[model samples]
Target chain A: MRLAAVLLFLATISAICHTDGYIEQVTQQIHLLRPRSGAAGYRLKDVDCLSWRLAVETNNVRNWKLVPEECEQYVGHYMLGKQYRKDCEIVAHSAIEYAKSLTLVGDGKDIWIFDIDETTLSNLPYYARSDVQFGALPYNDTKFNEWVAEGAAPPVPGSLRLYQTLLPLGFKIVFLTGTAERFKDIRISNLKAAGYYTWEQLILKGEADQGTSALVYKSKKRTELVDSGYRILGNLGDQWSDILGDNSGNRTFKVPDPMYYIS
Target chain B: MRLAAVLLFLATISAICHTDGYIEQVTQQIHLLRPRSGAAGYRLKDVDCLSWRLAVETNNVRNWKLVPEECEQYVGHYMLGKQYRKDCEIVAHSAIEYAKSLTLVGDGKDIWIFDIDETTLSNLPYYARSDVQFGALPYNDTKFNEWVAEGAAPPVPGSLRLYQTLLPLGFKIVFLTGTAERFKDIRISNLKAAGYYTWEQLILKGEADQGTSALVYKSKKRTELVDSGYRILGNLGDQWSDILGDNSGNRTFKVPDPMYYIS
Candidate 1:
């Protein structure tokens, strides 16, 4: 009976926690992460609100700067949760179902665009290591570049499934990555090693593409694809830039990546 | 050249719309549905903010009251959008993936709880009619009862898919609805007609259950399920009350319903 009483008390507290008004309050706090000034007298600098913003920003949603070092561990744990993986899998599965509904032209002009890093390949193992601090550590291009060159990064399971599923369905696949052009040969090798083989094209950023924003550069490539008569049926990426902008395919599926942000 | 200029202009607009801070502001406005007063000097009664809240409240998130009659058409159109369907599908697909990961205890005690109404059977057809009005129209029990008695509400495709998928995986299914017990016969018939055949139980609110808040009634029932030795692996529902409170199971998947919110 004592146990039952305790259980009842806990349940009551849990019920109160989830009230619609409470959730709304939390949601409002999440919104404080927006660039706008604080709401009248409410200070947006509240720690809890900032933490909530960090989580939201790291997820599929865009905006806010990189999470503070103090918040990195929390974000890292969140990313590693089963829930996060489930979210990604859900998006991928829905994308597949949508792909199945399309009436493919089968002219080999039906192409699916994929962003490589964090989309096709995951650097989770690298991030998981103690030496390489999770999201809190500023991005070191030299170290990251070395990791990419090693070609050991594993395929994100959801994306791997998507890649495998799209191939037999008569749609051409293409890799459009933001990695510098110099890593093209290594990237191809890494992709093949990671179970991705033979894309229609592997477009990388060249010297001429330097200084251009990711949104502009990727959109330009997609526009070129459209100009050349390729019907981009699907576009998959982690960042908003990868899927937004002009010439975005018929559908865009965003896979969650909270580890880092790219402009 | 002309086409390129047009695309550039559109792209610029898109980029501006997605900036981190701008999205946070939009997200904050959506949460103003809470009954609380506005933050500091920010008036919660602002018409534009209210309008925006009405639109979001009717889509994926939950908990705002019946929208104003003036916002009905806007919500109606939103419900009819392809994007809305896609978002629901994404959530359902993710739930299914999470379910697949659980190892059933095989005691016939492993159960999955599903909320009726928007979670399983969609009331869209009835709501879509011009005479019915969107969420803004006050809920008429007599008319809704008539619709239930007709046993024609279509099954939400995602929930139906989940229902079919779970049965084969050895999990017992149950319907735990807030619907009055008087409609049990019609509800059962409707479930069968809509392709959800067997379940461990169909629990409904009885006459004695009246005057109780939905959160309390639902939580008490779930507590009973737990006491009976059934391990609830997952609970899926459209309303927060369906998935919250006591014995919320190991996981809860919220299916979006921007229509009427039940307290």
Candidate 2:
């Protein structure tokens, strides 16, 4: 009996040691994975936040080329009015149903609003180079015009397919942006570069009232779109400011901006 | 016997279904996480084996800022360098180390090399803004030098610490860049703005080689460091080209460049 009891005690001690060791290993693993401590520290947080702060400060300074501030403004600066493309398409397709039910304007055709940068054309890649070089911010209007004339800005992902789908359904496309009036020629060139030829109207940022603030720039731009005599069925842009009328709307579609945006 | 056989049949069916479902789920998860299928989709087979052809062709065009050719060059532009304060603390340290190791030249502690963009100043934020408003490639030299002169460019993370660490060691500092030599006043102003009072040399791109390949341009510049009798112990810049020698002994350190490197 004594021998059996001694064996049990030894077994119990060994089991306890194993369990303690296992717990220690797991604790260490967790500690390592935790961001607030150890080798695998808050690396992502440091890089993302610091880089963003740096980008912002750099944009506000000397070489107009480092437009980090511009990127931040982009999210609020341009938005496709529809919350999602599918939602916008659905609402656009059903506009005829609504038109049949109401007195309607001159015609019951559909109109779509598109934000410029990430909608039919992408301009971020061109800007990314400027930040990298840090030499001098170049604004060669001739070169810009030439680039836009080339009409090589590829359609945003899923934009061409959807645009084609809507075109066949009697939907008229309208391009809108918070771009100042000075860039009219360049804007047209860029759209043409993207193989986009037949937009009904292009709405850009117009001069505002005496009290216009930077935040309201896009909102004012949207009011212009609303006044343009088109029953806005859907809106698309990368920024929230493009979609929301006063900036508020039902059907708003947005593409991701891995490169940059105003908001 | 009949009951046992029935039970076995049911168990087999259950096991087969479970195994099949498990296999399908695991396969789907695995596929979702792979590079070709991953969320970010940036997996390359190997750094060397993966050509920049796809990234260049797809991401670079006329509208994009950095051209395809430049993108291709960027992949192989990795180099090592370190940054120090203009106060000459780090230079002095390096000079002491050199004197201990080798025979004295003129002063045994004279020249220093500096990179322009991110090292001595900040330029990313300005680039970001131009990208949005301008929608063209970024380049604005006058403004770049102005920012430097303003000294608003924040020290790179940990750079100020390194600079403070190296001063008072007995070394004369020099600044060099691929910028034009004509901007000597601007460059000096920027350094002063950043708290760097004086430099033994302020070499610009034209002073080295006008329009040669960046790599070749950098190699020629290193000879000046040698000719100056300054035992180049540690060089500092954001890009690899700043510190890398054709064939020599210089301890190199790197500061991460999230914005992008021009050369």
- Kindly report, for each predicted structure in the order presented, the TM-score of its chain A compared with the true chain A: 0.78, 0.50
Residue-level lDDT of model 1, residues A1-263, one tens digit each, is 58557547645643211111111121111001122221111112223422243223222123334453335556667567664565556556656766776889899999999998878988887777554545444344567677887989888857888889899999899899888888888889999999998789999988787756677889999999999999999999877678867888877776766565555
Model 1 chain B poorest ten-residue lDDT run: B15-24
Clashes of 2: 70
What are the per-residue Cα lDDT tens digits for candidate 1 across B1-263? 58557556645643211111111121111111222221111112222322233223222122344453335555677668754465456456556666776888898999999998888998888888654665444445567677778999988857899899999999999899878887889899999999999999999888777756667888999999999999989888876677767888777766656666554
TM-score against native, each model: 0.45, 0.32
Restricted to chain B, the TM-score per model reads: 0.77, 0.53
lDDT of 1: 0.66
CAPRI-wise, candidate 1 is incorrect
Q: Please give the DockQ score of every candidate, comma-separated.
A: 0.02, 0.01
- DockQ of candidate 1, scored on C-alphas against the true complex (2 decimals): 0.02
Show pairs that collide, candidate 1: A35-B21, A63-B20, B58-B258, B59-B258
